[model samples]
Structure formats: structure tokens, C-alpha cells
Target: MSISSSGFSWPLRVYYEDTDVSGVVYHANYLKFFERARTEWLRSLGYSQESLRHEVEVAFTVSRVEVAFRSPARLDDQLIATVAVTELKRASLVMTQQLRLGDIDGRLLAEAEVKVVSVDAASFKPCALPDGFRNRVQTVENAASRNPSSSAA
Candidate 1:
């Protein structure tokens, strides 16, 4: 529910369905949380996935993900999911995302480095990111990098 030069932070509450039998968040749900955060980040910049596909004829697909689980997030836990673009290329981008307990600087439950590729929505073939989107991302990334206090952890 906050934004900094570091990234966009989205607050979420753990639901029973997001947990395993032991009440800990299921491993796969972390991916979902990351995805949602990324989506919201794009939305914050005025681009929705749907519009990107239909208007720009581009779609972003996850090409790789490397996650490190530091601690467990249990049911009813208030969490904050963060999305920060680390690297941006013509056809792809890399992001560092984290699930933290309570706040942006709270306990890190899990962190992921994700790479996403832009592709032709209809053919699903690799393609360069649309110019407008790319430009906007560059603006955000540049601003974040300039703000020393908002450096990623």
C-alpha cells in the first residue's frame, strides 16, 4: 500500500486458502503473490496486462524465477509484497520481489528474482517491449536509482 523509489508495495492478508495444512503459506502461493505485485506495479504506471495485450500486441511472460525462502508466513499474517525492477532490456526485464511480514522493512519471508520476456500476444513469440512501456519503465528505474534512500535491500 506504499510506493518508494525502491518499488511498489502492496499489502495483503494471508487467507486460509493461501496456506497449507500446517497453516503456513503454501510454496506456490508466493509465486502468485509476486505475480499480483507485478501486475499492480504495472497498473500503478497506467498499464494493465489486458491493455498491453490488446493495444500493444505484447504480453509479458515469466521466463525464469529464482526464489529463496527465509522464513515462514502463517495464516492471518499481514504481509507486504514488493516489486522492484532490477534490469530492463529491449525484450525483457528482471525484477526482485519480496514478501515481507507487516511492512516493507519487516521480516522477509521469501524473495525472488524473476525475469520476464515480452512476446507477441497472438503468436506468443518473443518480441521487444512496446516503446511506451519501455520508456515508462526506464523513467521509474532511473528515478529509483537516483533516490539513494530507497535502495533495495
Candidate 2:
């Protein structure tokens, strides 16, 4: 299994469409926000699910998602979504994710534990991660080792 990364963060801003009638972000909208962060995290590594499918004929799918609501995020609030690997198998990965409020001292907003499985595009069956994919993700681990917080400190 791959070890935990110190953590990766993606900045976001809560928009009007993301909220409910009460002005707080709907519970489920966080999932979309989280997904975007993860996807961007992968993009930062120079890979994308779409490219992974078109170029490598493989894609990642959410096998399971477990969310824990810790706090509310309101419209216009800047937030940060985090992604960190907790475990990795040949064909699946477990990630510990969190959403934190920005501008107010990095407060915890919500958290989730998500598991993803890689599958072949043609057959939609589980598949081992291609060498490139594994290597790219491993880059995150190495960077975390060098700078866990993604800061020069």
C-alpha cells in the first residue's frame, strides 16, 4: 500500500449555485468540490482521467465514498480541499480528504475518506495501474517527503 502523503491542497471559492435555501452550501455539493480538487491534484501531476482513458485506455472511478461533515461552508467563502493517500493496492486506492475554510485560519470544514478503483475503458473491469500512472502518483509521495506541507519550510 502507498503511504500517506503529508497532504495536497486545492483552493476553491463557494459560489451561489453551490448553496441551499439557507445560504449554506448543500451537503452533497462538497462531493463535487472534492472531486474537482482530486482531479486537479492529478492534473498537477501531468495526468488526467480523460487522458488516462484516451491515451492509456484506463480510467479511475469512485468505488466508494464516506464523508464526515464537520462544519458548514458558506457562499463566497474561500476554501481548500485536501487529498492524501492512505493506502494503495494494485487496482484501488484509499484517500483521506478534507475541506477546510480559507482566510479564517484554515478551519476544518468537512472531511471524507474516499476509495477509487481503476478500470479499463473498453471493458469497464478493474485493472492494474499502468506504470506511468503509478510513477506519476509516486511523484506526490516523493514531494511530500521533501516538503510535506508544500511549503519551503
Candidate 3:
């Protein structure tokens, strides 16, 4: 994992199960990779999705996503998925994620802009994020701002 002014990056290796018969990554699998990166980003901020639901009665659900595939990644390829918060609203967050080859200067494979809403665990109704969670997000946002080179996808 690597953290930059741009966002949180999680390393991934394309596996056999992640590929198609031709060994190219299946299109839908990119969503799974991006989702994992987002979850890990939340974990890095000292919050776990399961714990949030159990303790705070809150959970995040994807509300919208727009993805563009630039290239196909093959099985065994080293990859990095980066998640950056582009907007933080009371009940939702908009993020941009990029999947790239793990090289000196990563090669872009796919990019997506996703929106996720915080909702009541039981009711599944939109809800404002907890104060502490908001603060954590702000902290990361502030840090990213300090590193101007970190650009969103």
C-alpha cells in the first residue's frame, strides 16, 4: 500500500479467477478491485465497515459509478488501485479511482468516479456520517491538499 497526496493506493496482482478465458481481466472485476481499495482506505483511517455497522449503525453503499477501461490487464500482472475522495457530503462521498500497472510510473488501465452514500445499517436510509468519521476524512483531505502533485482521476 502507498499513500500520496493523490490518494490511497492498494497493490493487487491479477489472479486466474480475475481473468477471462483469454487471461485478460474481466471488465466487472475492476469494480471489485476499486471497492477493495476504498474499503482499505477506510480501514487505514481507523474504521472498519463491519465495525461501523455494528457500533455506529452506519454503512456505505454505492449509489453511482462511471468507469472507463483504457487497457486490459492480464493474469499475474502487478497492479495498483488508488482511491481518492473528490467530494465529501453530509450523507455521501464522491471518489475517483484508478487502476494502473505497478511500474515506476504506473500505466493507467482503468479509471472510475464513484459515489457512495452513508446509510443507516438497519433502515438503509441516507444519514450523515459520524463526527469522528468526518474528521478522519477531513484529515486525509487536508494532507492531500498539501501535496499538490496528487491529482484525482
Best by lDDT: 3
Model 2 agreement with the true structure over 64-142: per-residue lDDT tens digits = 9999998899999999898887887899878888899877688898999999999999999999988877876777766
- Winner by TM-score between candidate 3 and candidate 2: 2
Ranking of predictions according to TM-score: 2, 3, 1
Point out where model 2 deviates above 4 Å: 151-153
Question: lDDT at 40 for candidate 2?
Answer: 83
lDDT winner, 2 or 3: 3
lDDT of 3 by residue, 29-101 (tens): 9999999999989988889999999999999999999999999999999999998888888888898899999
Q: How close is candidate 3 to the true structure, as a TM-score?
A: 0.92
User: Considering summed lDDT, which 10 consecutive residues are worst modelled in model 3?
Assistant: 1-10
- Pairwise lDDT winner, candidates 1 and 2: 1
Identify the superior model by lDDT, candidate 1 or candidate 3.
Answer: 3
TM-score of each: 0.90, 0.93, 0.92
Model 1 ranges with Cα > 4 A deviation: 1-5, 103-105, 148-153
Residue 139 lDDT in candidate 1:
80
- What is the per-residue lDDT of model 1 for residues 1-153, given as tens digits with 9 covering 90 to 100? 112347778888899999999999999999998998899889877899999999989999999999999999999999989888888888998988999998555999999999999999999999998888988887876777678555332
